[model samples]
Target: MVQSALWDFLRGQFTRLPYPETTFTDQVVIVTGSNVGLGFEAAKHCTRLNAAKVILAVRNLDKGNAAKRAIEEATGRRGGVVEVWPLDLSSYESVKAFAQRAMRLPRLDVLLENAGIAGPPYRLAEDNESTITVNVVSTFLLGLLLLPKLRETGQRYNNTPRLPHLVIVSSGVHYFTKLPEQSAPEGKILATLNDKATANMGDRYNVSKLLEVLFTRELAARSPLPSQAGNARGKGGVIINYLNPGLCHSELARNAGLGLKFMKFLLARSTEVGSRTLVHAASAGEETHGQYLSDCKVSRVSPLVSNDTEKHGGKLHTRIWDEIVRKLEAIQPGIMQNL
Candidate 1:
């Protein structure tokens, strides 16, 4: 966690992730925020690999349709193998609606939670800060809502070569963030983030990534990843994992300071190159369950989330998980059953 920022950035720039070649033939996949950047590129990859249906879940239908057309033309495959669907993570109702629609899918093989935002000027979405609401809360809301579907797909597709995956697009920025907001009083972690007086926009994105890492680990712990032996006893089936795509050439940092923009131009990978890891993580097998990935390989996390220690001091891990579960349960009663 104490590595030089310059060294880390330079390393990420030079070490490339190989383009994923995994075939997703006939699999149903969803990539949220697929209208542009990494999400768009990842969805394109899925289409190229022959996924039966690639759902482009976006906030804007126009952009989503445009992306769908572009992908269809690029792949020279038509007839709706790639479909656009409305998914505005900023609203709870929108996320719920999206989940309801997904439930009708014959099967869902992968869900890449790629939508997120950085904050500077304050804004609220639903019951929390816009970044927290969209990035952490709604992201998980959709995931939790569709957990039963993912589990069901595992059983339904048991004979197939495909595996179910729920991959979240987290970031290595989490390693640099201390997540000071977490120091707030018990049960006030998210409340403190919503407090404009206490909210630190300077590091909101990083903090959100840290939360994603924490939440993914906790969920995997509670539900347990499907085992390689098969979903025996229904103990494990879907592979739930998160990854750090590193600094990529994308619009995700559009709100950052000018200096940061210059740094990104010099240090970031291409949008296509960065998204390779997304495809890789999605197709990776049982070993990746609850693990953090970087550059297409399992990687280390900051000590705050390091698995070497049980629960990273125990209390911080459990307290944060408790707070999130409470909020999620409030949003969707009996939601934990899906996990």
Candidate 2:
């Protein structure tokens, strides 16, 4: 079969375009699941630019270390500045520990909540929450936990003029799903059921992705407000932006089973091809804030996502935030204060 013209165009552009230059030099980037796939590729770009530090936050310590070594070698840096921190996005306790430890370090310049699980059969987290918790809630906790450090980075450099950026690597899947109007039920009730009960994996994943976008927009609105008011002298804007990296052949699909594997073999882009959107969002200038990016350009997201209609997009945002706060509070009474 002949490939679609759009695919051909994207393929050509993806191949000939040079990798984006080091826009994040001397910056600190924390990439969850940076040991492999698009996260690893993004981390490479950070090191190439001489980032002050790149933290490979992953659940697998060995894999994280190996990726760090590869980055250091490829960049030809004399010393290994990239280090690994163990983190599991599925459990609230694990998320708490990871965030608390990161808080003690110097302020972070960027937090890439890139780790995610896709299309796994229904599995319960330690807290018995749904896979959405792993994909969405845990990420929220991690980002919120790092807020103070991210803010401090902004505050310390507010005079210098560069804003700290947080990039959320979400998927286009959210175009088709909707968030719960209320809390996520109890325990793993939502997680234990297959997509049939909570829609399909595609729907669940899409809902999670939309949640990320809402969180980013809301966070961005609140963050810059205080600083803009001049209440804090050293305040800096914590810009949150979201991007969809398109399908790539990576462990992200390892559990998608045989059909997905075969499809990916034919249609999926390489990890490098998929990382462009992410790299751009992470390094783009101030003009790119709060935009949904794809194909290395700022483009309109699906109407279902950007829409503000109560029946569609608008209500979902409020609902997601409410659920997020509810879950976070359940996990820890006053965690939102740090955020």
Alpha-carbon local distance difference test for all models: 0.87, 0.71
TM-score top scorer:
1
Please give, for residues 1-339, the per-residue lDDT of candidate 2 as tens digits. Answer: 023424533463444334777567668888888899999988888777778788888988988888988888888864657888999887788888988888787768888878988774656675533667777778877888787788788878776436677788887655555444234554432343333456455456666677677766666555563445567645666767788787687788676768868767877778877776677777775555666766676656555556653456565555556757777777878868865
Give per-candidate clash totals: 2, 3
TM-score of 1: 0.95
lDDT of 2: 0.71
TM-score attained by model 2: 0.84
| Per-residue C-alpha lDDT of model 1 across residues 254-314, encoded as one tens digit per residue | 8789888898877778999999989999999778988999878888877777742465465
Q: Cα deviation in Å at residue 219, candidate 2?
A: 2.7
Residue 227's lDDT within candidate 2 is: 41
